[model samples]
Target chain A: MVCIRFLKALQSVLDSRITVLYETHKGLGARFVDFAGWRMPVLYSGVVEEHMAVREACGIFDVSHMGEIEVSGPGAEAAVQYIASNDIERIVDGQCQYTLVCNDTGGVIDDTIVYRRSADNFLFCTNAINTDSVFCWLLEKLHGREGVEVIDRSGEYAQIAIQGPASLDIFKIAFGIDTEEIRPFRFIETTVAGSLAIVSKTGYTGEQGLEIYLAPASAPAAWDALMAAGAGHGIKPIGLGARDTLRLEMGYPLYGYEITEEFGPIEAGLKRFVALEKGGFIGQKAMVERAEGAPKSVLVGLRMEGSGVPRTGYELFSGDKAAGNVTSGTHSPALKYGVAMAYVAPEFKEPGTRLNMQIRKRSVECTVVAIPFYRREKK
Target chain B: MEFPEDLKYSKEHEWVRLEGDTAVIGITDYAQDSLGDVVYVELPAEGDAVTRGETFGVVESVKAVSDLYSPVSGSVVEMNDAVVDGPEAINEDPYTEAWMLKIELDNIEELEELLSADEYQQFIEEEK
Candidate 1:
């Protein structure tokens, strides 16, 4: 491995105005890109290669850019439930629930993963750019409350995700922790790499994997230990590039791309995660109205029939009519065909409906297909 | 990184080779290296008029789409259909095998604006 101190100095000299990775992703031959005001690695090896590594064997990702917020104290339970779109009461201790923070109009503020550590303590994993804003929002929500505390612990933690079919076994090998007991959405606070970490069995990709949230100071040791343990396991370091493709293939909604301030969970096909029955939350009325009324547009998957790549902001046309716009699209590295998720008219949201993706001045034909272009085979 | 000494270069990192009054144009090695995995290439058809320093085509990589500028003001004489058919040619051999277009020069004086191999090397260095 490359030296961390040397790279830290080199990166500072190179770009002085960006978030530096304390776990040392810079020295690992990662190609850094300016992502959401931070110099984050977009790729270490080729995206397709690293992607295949995750799908076939094992791959590790430095997802330290994801923000974390701590909400713990008296009445934290009710406060978290009020702030989140999902039913946080459903999860027991050491369980995570995928959720969304919504605007008053039911538009999604941000999609987040809320981990319930205890009845009075909940931790939210927010999107990197949305951390400060969400923290401020949480603070604003606790105005009438006396004991609830919202602390932005985004910078204090480093999140390393080891994802693949072999990720569980590899986790056990690397950290001497058996995660077989940690079923889907379940997590365990364990000693890993000689540091306390929360190993969660959750992933963006539709694979059995672990997301280890550890202290920033102990991240390098954990990363090194994982790498050393995974050396014989065909482990590759994945980057944000592969991360995009993997999540996209799984039909996962990225915050800005799919779930944004422009749309709500019902329109984004996250109805299961949104708990309207639980009630007593922001955007609850708007969500109820949306559920009772006809939505303007709904998210759907598209499979390209022709050759051109369908990218974000690409217009969708139904015959000669303007259908909608592509939110997140990519040439799916797994399928070897172009795949995309877009919001379209109600008529075009049905499967087998033909549409076109406007690339440059030309249109590439596509068809509305089911979401999640890839799913791992159950053993 | 390989900037052939024989071929001339433009400020936009396009290489030019003089074939009598005609100029063969393609992006330089540095250009392709930066683009990374050219997935799709869109080029103007033959007989299309292209002005100097204007977009003649677009090269789409896995990352982003970049406009390809013409090195000289001319009418397109020939098109390299290979790049449109298989875009990876641009990444594999951007100089010879992936020539974007051949233009019938409107004015040979435009060649004076082009840079030599040494000057282009310095230009790229300053850019870095």
Candidate 2:
């Protein structure tokens, strides 16, 4: 009886409302477009200038729109293990792990960050659009369990991602927290601008940086503190324009655009998260049956040999026959070439496999490359 | 922002300079700004016949790659080698040194039908 009511409440929350992050810049001349119900910043200045800022110097990204959730109580770890594809048994306090929450059919519900705050408490940082759906899914799963508590902390918190090579120094000076001791995927709770913040050594840009989480009311102060400290070091408050290109360069998948419900985690090259060894979880039986082999349209990186760019929805052809379509593409600022990720027939997923993109109905020759068209230099 | 009075413009943000039987063609400043960071250009082969309002090639930027349409019916006589080699010239200077192609105008009357510099500026403003 309680499970049924809990499921109803969870469904109501999912259907309630969509939150948007609007930046009123006083008509600085930006072409605003609606993305996943959020009016995100595509480009404030220019895509190239902003892209260069992150690669060369540093850039501050307003990532407050990302969803934040908290799980606590005795059954927190059990609930998380059942909900997530990766085993959470090894997660220690003050560390984070990137994993996915999948549907029963092994389809991705959302890719998120699991931050274990303590033995019985953790946080799930999810993509903005998947907030309500993920929360509902977690609740629905937890409704059948006993002594599990899940809270939607998204409204209470705001996140700012300071990314790029210069991020560590800027973060250290801004928050007066020594970042040298903080390793990748580790976090430390500290005060920034007289407000409590949890600084995590993690970012989507594949650089040395910290994602500072603070109270929603303290956002303005936190933003100001970081900008002021990073002003001399060439840290600019970048928009979603550079953020997409930076992640694209690193070949990170964006939900709905790259990874979708129609494509399972195995086809998307994310089988590392699904642990068959773990006793049981949602999607376990189906994943186990398909583990032997499943004919999949595999995801791969596409690079143009000629003077053209392969964009999303552009048909990928293997000698006049349609094989797949591009999921994401951009002129990589670091490589200075057009790069894209796409799903193609498994037979043609190997590197150096020649393919063609239908640009304006004409096939432009391209080659399949390994994932992550660009990688950060080892320090 | 500098739209020379002698040039004729298209609503798609292409500019043409009528030179008797031939017209030089390129994109306007507004087009470059909207596209942002011209990285590569695909120009049609010389002597390829093209019609007005038909896509001839593509111009790639960091954000998107859009089709470049022909503003006048003609055969492609020559393409700007400078802009092809260094595409940033299109964003740096779209009018003089960054002209895209030279077309032997099939009908000179097509130029008279295009928007004048003043009209083009007004069209851009209306778009905004």
DockQ for the candidates, in order: 0.35, 0.67
Give the CA lDDT, 0 to 100, for residue A127 in model 2.
94
Q: Judged by lDDT against the true structure, how good is candidate 2?
A: 0.82
Worst 10 residues of 2 chain A by lDDT: A17-26
Which tens-of-lDDT digit does each residue in A140-245 have in candidate 2? 8888678789899988877888888888888778877788789999998888766788889999887778898888777777777777889999887777778888
lDDT of 1 by residue, A161-188 (tens): 9999888888888777888887899999
Candidate 2: the clashing residue pairs are none
Best by DockQ: 2
Q: Cα deviation in Å at residue A21, candidate 1?
A: 2.8
Model 2 residue B104 CA deviation in Å: 2.5
Please provide, for model 2 over B24-110, each residue's C-alpha lDDT reduced to its tens digit, 9 standing for 90 to 100: 999999999888888888888789988899998889888877889889999999988888889999999999999988999888988
Misplaced by over 4 Å in model 2 are: A1-31, A320-322
- For all candidates in order, the CA lDDT equals 0.86, 0.82
